[model samples]
Target: MNFYNIVRVSVVAALLGTSCLPAAAVSPPPARTSAVTNEDERLLALFRDDQRREQAIDPLGMLYRTGKSDPALLRQVFTDNPVRALNKSVKLSLSALKKIDRAKLSPERQISYDVFLYDKTEEAFWLRPDMLALTQVTPLDHFGGLHIQFPSLMAKGSAVSYDNVADYEDALAVDRAFPFVLDNAVVRFRQGLDSGVVTSRLTTANMIAQIDGLLAQPIEDSPFYSPVRDFPDTVPMSERTRLQKAYFAAIRDEIYPAYRRLRAFLNDEYLPAAREQVGILGMKGGPGLYRHLIEQQTTLPLEPEAIYQLGLSEVARIQREMDVVRKEMGYGEGDLRSFFDTMRSDPKFHPKTKEELANGFSAVGHRVDELVPLFFNHVPRTKLLIQPYPAYREKYEAGGSYNQGAPDGSRPGIFFYNTYDLPSRFLTGIDTLYLHEGAPGHHFQISLAQENTALPDFQRFGGNNAYVEGWALYAETLGYEMGFYKDPMQHWGTLDDEMLRAMRLVVDTGIHFKGWTRDQAIDYMLSNSGMGRSDATAEVERYIAWPGQALGYKIGALTIQRLRKKAETELGPKFDIRAFHDQVLMSGALPLPILEAKIDRWIASQKG
Candidate 1:
């Protein structure tokens, strides 16, 4: 994964709206409101212009590591204070909305109004009084810490120049962009290092061990490795070698040392100060932090308890369905747990090689494409490609992921299959996986958003996990409707995948929020989903490393299912699945509530 892509991931996390605005609509700001004076409007305009320029120049700032560290440029970019600019922009937007005579606005403006309302509501979650102070403190600390720790990599130098850096700066900037959240992460990282809970020596030893393990084998010998024998032609020869050398050196020197320091700090200092209690409920300003994350990720005011309860309900409901599916397959005599065990161990389901894995993915795309017309009329013009995971990040990416292409059509939307462990890439679930990760799922929805020029820049490339992932999850079910899941065994794969997601809801919260140990979380996943122990452990660790993310998949899927059901009941015979799907995709990715509202309006239109 490019570093910039990581930052894009974080920004996508913050924006929560995952659709691109149409290019034609990327124009000047709208007229000023009467409630706000010309001066305010002028200030707002300046801010918007400056920010837009910054966005256009470096949309994924700090995340694009070209390996060239120019301190002067870095200082200039960070010095302007984006938070202040964003604050002013948010205020001006709200003022304009307030001044609007809602009844007088044209229908098109009304759509903007609806979008603005959603944006305002979501922003409030991030700027809540309790969170503002901490949020501000955190980003500064992260920036300061990174600068201090990796001065060689981040300082002004030939090495840190654009040509040499990796794009991961975007991910780093995500924390920087939101100081409050970044501050918390820094505090957590530091604390984890300080209290002897995680010793520097141990972390260094582990990292070195991992690195050595990586170096011990020839690149071709590891299934996970993809050798980048030559740099892209886009990069000059001299710059490419320089960057490659700098990148490796930084990893060996700066990053490794920083990791060691952080580990020591966590082991010696932070953990001792760390609270024993679990969940966002017990931390200082816990309620506000939780609210901020919810708003930041989901674009809603839903309380943590409400989400937790929803997870519980979803788990029970899905489990019951699993039971029924098991019985239908003549496994009723065995427990669901035992049934999953049999399903996972069945050798008939496993793919044998990298080519087979890629071919399986391609086959799924072909099959799903045929079925898409059954449920969607406004299918995306964007193409989808199934490829193997890139070498550098295969260890970290999920089993498979859908990478949306650049808006200007520079790249095709890529569905990267992790052929790193081919056996793990089973054939049983390939069709459903393709549907969720490729057509009519992430690729379709995200690409449509990117293509929508009418949306604001903030909305165009933004993503809310619940909405985006939910839609994908919902897309999984479309397999049944499309008549693609003809094999009972394949249907079992769908259930297994669904069960894995449901189990994530239970285990993620259990580990991070409920104080369940890592092992405890792993055990729950293994026992519930029949996933191999290694995969289960990796997943549990991922949840710990990235809190609240796992909840999005199952939660989002359920919301879509609920909305579709509501549409069916209300529209009766009038409900057209294709039209309904079009409405969902055309509106772009929204917060769950906004999505429901949009769907309801669509249902009303159909009824009339």
Candidate 2:
């Protein structure tokens, strides 16, 4: 998933609440003729242009801070007013979609549409006002805050100031637009289900239960309450405290209760009804849908068995490397599984305190920045910050995560370290994690994408999972070539991480497609890699929660590796890795096929 969708996916199941804005007095319209004067036209034109620009960029900021499940608010912003000119733009988009040949569209775009079309309930849930408020509202003013340009336009239409109206209207518009998108999505979803491409009835039932639970919550008890308030983090000290109290009140009253309802529903109404059978093969046209997902994700037209086999080969290759590391660590004849246990239990690897863990991550961030110049000439102007994960989310966050800043530079890219379990936090692979999630990995690629004004909004601030995750994985290896992994243990940590991802290719498919139990997947990871039990358990649950996502890292990394090797061989001695990297970053993120096409063009130009 791209960054925008990531926020939507994460938050769709959560409850949120917002205070009602004071009603605005009706405003007199500016003098108008059948045709507006040039100056008036210019003003409206400028406003419309600004609105579209903000709309495009808004999703990026929204995804980072909140999840993306709200479509109702999106529809309102794009199409709420019957007389609004922006509604014309929505019509224009529909027209464009109709005019284009579905088959002729790029595979990535097609998959995007197909996914959207098949999942009406999800589309509706994503566009809901609460969902939009949860995902889009933030402390940053320019992007989600009141001072932003689009807010100014909305305020002009209403009597409220830009700041007050922006949040409410943006939220309202998204809620309105959500159902329309879901209507289209349901059509596609049924087709996929019938065809046997997406046969996970259990997953669907769980998702539905989650949504039902969210809907049951009272708005006052939502986790999203703080974010939806007028000045999320900037209320006067007294007001801030009030807001915080209200936020928790809402979480307890609305959000948690909703989650419990859904959880109970899943257990009572859905789980038992789920099927025991696996794979898309039983669906009428299952092979085709599976083909489409593979094509969309890998950007290749390989069959499921071929993709599965490719995963198997990669797993074997990474295990061999892990064995080499094991022997070097002097664990002769000790199976890889035992080594993983030793690494997990070793007190020497654990952090003494949360502060120490945060500082250790900060140090890794600095070290990565130092080596960045060695590998590439072009570097992002964006700043990076290493912070502990917010207290509310530390328990569930990945080991480390990168939240990219706004395209307009309102926020700095943040690398949030999860320090909930200190024993699980260690020096074992901190450097690799930093490189993968922070400097020269997500931060670099994402910031550069936001900085590129030349690319379309979708190409610039948006991305494919394969490209985003793949590039991050590739960044990990660069640490070695740039001389940052001087310590043998650190180097081994990098390989261990890589091995973990490769193993995912096997385990993800194993669980969802092959019916392997959760324990079996955890056991496989324990036997193959030196990860802590808590960490391994978390990773396994993540795959269970999100199928197919684990495959993206290995698939993406290997694709880039193949591309780099091809570039080196084709360019011979003249090939400069720095220049090649610049070319890659300059285009921002694209579908792998598009990236490959661009690289081929770059190579051809260099030859001439």
Error of 1 at 109 (Å): 3.3
Q: Taking the tens digit of each residue's C-alpha lDDT, what string does model 1 give over 1-608? A: 10111113222122221111211113345454454444444433433553453343232232222232223323322222444444555665676566656555543344445665666555554554444443332221111123221321232221123322243233233222322322334453443334322212222233333334334444333211111234445556666555545444444444444445544544455545555543434445544554556545555555566676776776677677778777877776879888767766767667777787788777777877776677777766667778776553455456777656655444467776676666555677777777778777888888787666655444455546777788888888988877776677678678778877888777765754566776687787777665666567656655553446667777778778988899999988888888888777765667677677778777878888
Q: What are the Cα lDDT values of the candidates?
A: 0.54, 0.54
Per residue, candidate 2 scores C-alpha lDDT tens digits across 474-558 of 9998888877676767777888888888887777667756667768888988777778777787777666544465677778888
Q: Which candidate is the best by TM-score?
A: 1
Q: Report model 1's TM-score to 2 decimal places.
A: 0.73
Error of 2 at 353 (Å): 2.6
Count residue pairs with overlapping backbones in model 2: 37
Clashes of each: 62, 37
